[model samples]
Target chain A: MTAHPLHVPPGPVDLDAIATDATPGYGGSKSDGKAALEGLGPELADLQERLFAEGRATGSRRRVLLVLQGMDTSGKGGTLRHTVGLVDPQGVRISSFKAPTADELAHDFLWRIRRAVPAPGYLGVFDRSHYEDVLIARVNELAAPEEIERRYDAINEFERELVEDGTVVLKCLLHISKDEQRERLLARLDNPEKYWKYEPGDIDARARWDDYRAAYELALERTNTAHAPWHVVPSDRKWFRNLAVGTLLLDALRGLDLGWPAADFDVDAERARLLASEAST
Target chain B: MTAHPLHVPPGPVDLDAIATDATPGYGGSKSDGKAALEGLGPELADLQERLFAEGRATGSRRRVLLVLQGMDTSGKGGTLRHTVGLVDPQGVRISSFKAPTADELAHDFLWRIRRAVPAPGYLGVFDRSHYEDVLIARVNELAAPEEIERRYDAINEFERELVEDGTVVLKCLLHISKDEQRERLLARLDNPEKYWKYEPGDIDARARWDDYRAAYELALERTNTAHAPWHVVPSDRKWFRNLAVGTLLLDALRGLDLGWPAADFDVDAERARLLASEAST
Candidate 1:
């Protein structure tokens, strides 16, 4: 399998260096990209089933965690509907984090996140995950500067623990330009069908676009590790974004090298039992 | 828009009366039925989104709970993969109930069931559900006969509470014959790929099929109410079963009469704000 080309390299990061509309490894037209994404369904489903089977039969602890972070209208929900929808929903656990509740605020930030981790053999998706602690928390001054600085290390340690325990943490920063966000927001405002998605607070966030961008750049730079790397997915084109994330997931599942679990019971004995039961019926 | 013919009416239910292979309301070929199920997808998705938007915008508590109860090898998992897989996973919450833990057993049976109910606007599916308390427990005499008798009333009241609270409870018993189950078990035994799904205890349960069927009949007769009806879906043909359940879900959604949520904010103001933001960018 070809290596994903969107991986964020370790160094001082510049968000503007990559174009939000560029379809990095894919050279296909929009229609072709969609077809390619649909083509990934069978293989992704098979691999996911094998992984699930391994966990049930052999008690394998291996799992996958796909964390999606993006600006408003950067398409986290779309990625879930299009890319993650390709696999069996039984084998996937999706948790979307919202603003911290009073109970959540009382506990450590990771408290809610820890509870939502997927069980063995499940693909866990975090939409706007713990990274929000550093992103929004930083931009809005929700925490003290020292405490905000400390969360970066805390997140790294928490993710490293997950990786060491056999979780393949694949993080994607859905990169979109301010112009694209403005256009998407305007589209939502223009269509009554999309009105429910538009929030007044979205404009407030857009107003602090440069601040959020700097926060994201720092978050990506500090947390990008060998065990769990961050991929910057260009998101201006919804089709390419969906296709890239699907391909990345397929690659991760393929890396598991999963196979059909061996039967624990005697096959011949089970066969005889079935036949006798059939005869009796 | 046709009424589902598989619904178990308020009178006595004979498990043997309903043919396990009959497609009562549908008269299409297997391929045609499959196509028909696929055709329900777009409408299902649209209605689900409307329901979701309504919940988000207006705080509507209306939700759908699909309870799937069936014998082992009766295609509950297959139905989930094919039928429930139609809608966006974000809008669907699926919980598979297994043997209760010590924590769960300490409380009432409905304790865990209550915890897994879907939030407002979400479509919740139970792979196996509270019905198990009646079916497996009564078949095995796990509870006292008097206690078991009282649970029928308890379940009815419980479902009534859910229904009155704006939940549409749609229960389906995936009905299959003993011969069909034997064939399915045999097929599992013959295929190593299906080994993970086969359990030694499944044969144990198969040995007491008649008792389990009797228990099911009693449970359905007692708990079947005007508010929460039970549908006996024939599971001999996988395609028909998928289509039946998908159609039932679509009907339920359409019955909700969901419309696109009206915008809460001033549309023109947000539009102007977006344009101004674009100008600033």
Candidate 2:
């Protein structure tokens, strides 16, 4: 069995070279990948508690921010359900950024983004993040070229600040082919039950494929900083996408090297209190 | 294979008669009960979407409110994971009411409860609900007997309004024996990994077991109105508790008999637009 590489480090990333169907970091079949995912559940739960406890402790500023940016059928929701679903909800904050509201549009783009950052001792997940401003904004000419360029620099500075202040920023671009998106959209149309999830405007989004791809390439190249690097995940195969993203997340948490805080109080006295209280009752 | 009777209708209640060890509604082993729970997932997802779509459609106000009240270690979290975990997060609302803050204490107790009701087309679960006002308040003498009795009447009236407005309120008391609580508390103590979940104050709560049980019985009897009936779920066997509660919830949903709302737009025109759009591109 060959070792699968999960992370694409901060450097020049060739989007075309990464196949959407390739399964890296997975040794066996779907069942095996599932078993592996199940195995990670308890570890994530335990690690999450320590992160939570550390945050709850005096002046500990440790947390994680996972940004998942992808095309419409690239399986961000599936990844969240399969991976982050394993941990206790108490320690995980999910921020699904939708379109800007009237008040939200009144503020800067990062204003809502800043408001949604996870507190210390949390594993925060951003479903569609501020990256949309660069991706969709550039593709559709929502912002001027000069403004978009300025936004990229602003994003880099914001991420650097987050990293310096104790947050681990992991950004993943769920890479899928245009053909895959077409099939997924068609399936939603065929199933009436899935009508709530479909939108005719998605067809328009598909028409801007090349533009979006070029915008993504520029965004990936421009903002892949050392402090907050970008990972390109092949997301056509749902199971493999779940596996790779889960692997990346587990590795990142493991890298934190968090330890249980030592009990500052006398353990013997607490045990004695329990014993004494039991006898009195 | 004996059938289990899980739901207790609106009537006088007895805490002692319900056997915590029994696993009714489940005729098979743990693996089989698990398989049954798994089967409910897709149906729940489908029903939830219809409910969500119905809510989104127009003015249809159909929803589910599952109030889970249990003593310590009766598996409210476990039930949430196994059962409600199956549905989409988009169509579910979870309100885990903890001890009230100073602002909350200043207002009437039901003020906070009113704030967390589920919107139309969502299945809402309250982890520790408004019943705490009656349970802990009565047991710990936080409120006078007259005030506690008044709260019972207030609760019934509040629930009546919810029922009239298209909410099916299913209140479940996860009834576990004192012995089961002791075992679970000790298990938490024995495992270092689970220390974060363990509270030292739990032992003090156990000391007032009979008082709590009597409180639950009186609360159940007083508030068991026709609009919102209390279901005493025997929860010692974790698998059975999930199955019984899951069954009750699924039944309640099926009872609503919801259907997918018809597409308001012209279907042929939309399909033709997609086909034409594809050819033009």
Candidate 3:
């Protein structure tokens, strides 16, 4: 019997939904995200227990890759910090990709990223991912028009390969408005404590805000494959973003159907016997 | 008034304690380690909070370095994992030094390590540290006699400088008996799940344990200075090792009288106002 490979659709993301101007009020009052997260928390806790137990019992673990891509100041770090809080460190890994090394830039765009994938039974969080090709590379005019075209195809194929091999790909694009970004940037500048978060370069990026939005739209349209659909999250509301992202992560992890390996012994019975032995001794 | 620095010591480490057989029953009973950790938790938590709050408020966060050196089966990772749990991530950092990379080896021994120093108001944990000059460099016969001498002097001076500049340096040497190590090694080999943790090369190292001991003894004798004292922990008991190490770290952090930076405004009082604004809107 021949094995069936996973299939992916090549389609552009519906940009209208992503860029919707509905002033749904930041972190909606109705609490859909919160309600969803409450349901997801126990599932995440269970998954974490199973994952760690299996890792220790079997000595083999599955790896998870959570890729986050978004506009500047889109709370990527915040999301990462919160997401990891749910899982065990023994089975989790995080890598934040900043500027590529000279060696990294010399190779194909995906080369450096592919090397950082987590081993099985582990979770790897990518702050910015291969989509850098479609974001920073486009914004800074670092690559030629044709190079960008090649990269989009390469990323799709690369993600497909990871998913086919039991790697779960969960990607999020944090959505925030230009005005909201301006306010946040101002807040960073106004607060002496947050001054470290701001850079003069950020202002230059802000000036090209329209360009970034158009670039993001194109990226979502061109690279949002079925195996890895981009979740456009409304992130003006911090609590809502956390709730939404946390719920999505919990759901994705639960869907993997992770379970503890069969025990080497009946732990309860053995534990009781060990306790009795100690008592007698 | 003539400005003068504090009467600082030659090195941060306490050399006197290094050579002593500090732990009589290391690896003997795991319960001892658990008790030590229990006593340390609150102290560590308090210090971590103070340091993190100071860092966030003042932005002049001091750096802390805890260096762990041990034999193959000793509990460096366990010590670090437990210690890190006591501190906030925003206020702590950990780096496990593996064998030198080609780029690392090309520079001075401390080049790679120096970069791993935590930012201000942060704790940096080194799984193993520059003591490799005396430990592995001596064991593996990597450095020339003169070069090794220079490193020891350099390490002493470097650590002294860090302490003078407000970096706290705490070093621990986890000491386990040969018989205890052998049993732990055997357990690793016997447990199929833990087999991966055992390397055939460890057996080779076990054979040369005497040489490693000599190197460690020499490291303690020469490099342990007044500012940094090497706490030789009994690690035959993994739980006890964790506890002793945690206690040591908590003590170091608590010794530093960290407090909140002078607030320009009453932020907590303002919190209610901010929430009210959100509610009114």
Q: By lDDT, who's the top model here?
A: 1
Across all models, the iRMS values in order are 1.8, 4.0, 10.7
lDDT order, best first, reads: 1, 2, 3
Between candidates 2 and 3, which one is better according to lDDT? 2
Task: Give one digit per residue, the lDDT tens place, for model 1 in B1-281.
Answer: 22254988787889899988988888788889888899999999999999888877887899999999999999898898887799888888888898999999999989999999988988899999988888899999888899888899989999999998899999999999998898888888889998998998898899999899899999999998998989999988888888999999999999999999898899998888778774433
Top DockQ prediction, candidate number: 1
Q: Score the docking of each candidate (DockQ).
A: 0.66, 0.20, 0.07
**Model 3 / residue B221 / CA error / Å:** 1.5
Per-model chain A TM: 0.96, 0.92, 0.82
Evaluate model 1 with DockQ and give the value.
0.66
Q: For every candidate, what share of the true interface contacts is present?
A: 0.64, 0.06, 0.00
Ten contiguous residues with the weakest lDDT in model 3 chain B: B1-10
Give candidate 1's error at residue A209 in angstroms: 0.6
How does model 2 fare in lDDT? 0.80
Indicate the residue-level lDDT of A75 in model 3. Answer: 82
The alpha-carbon deviation from the true structure for residue A153 of candidate 2, after best TM-score superposition, in angstroms, is 5.6
Angstrom error at residue B81, model 3:
2.3
| Over 4 Å off, model 1 | A1-5, A278-281, B1-5, B278-281
Arrange candidates by TM-score, descending: 1, 2, 3
Q: What is the overall TM-score of model 2 with all chains considered together?
A: 0.81
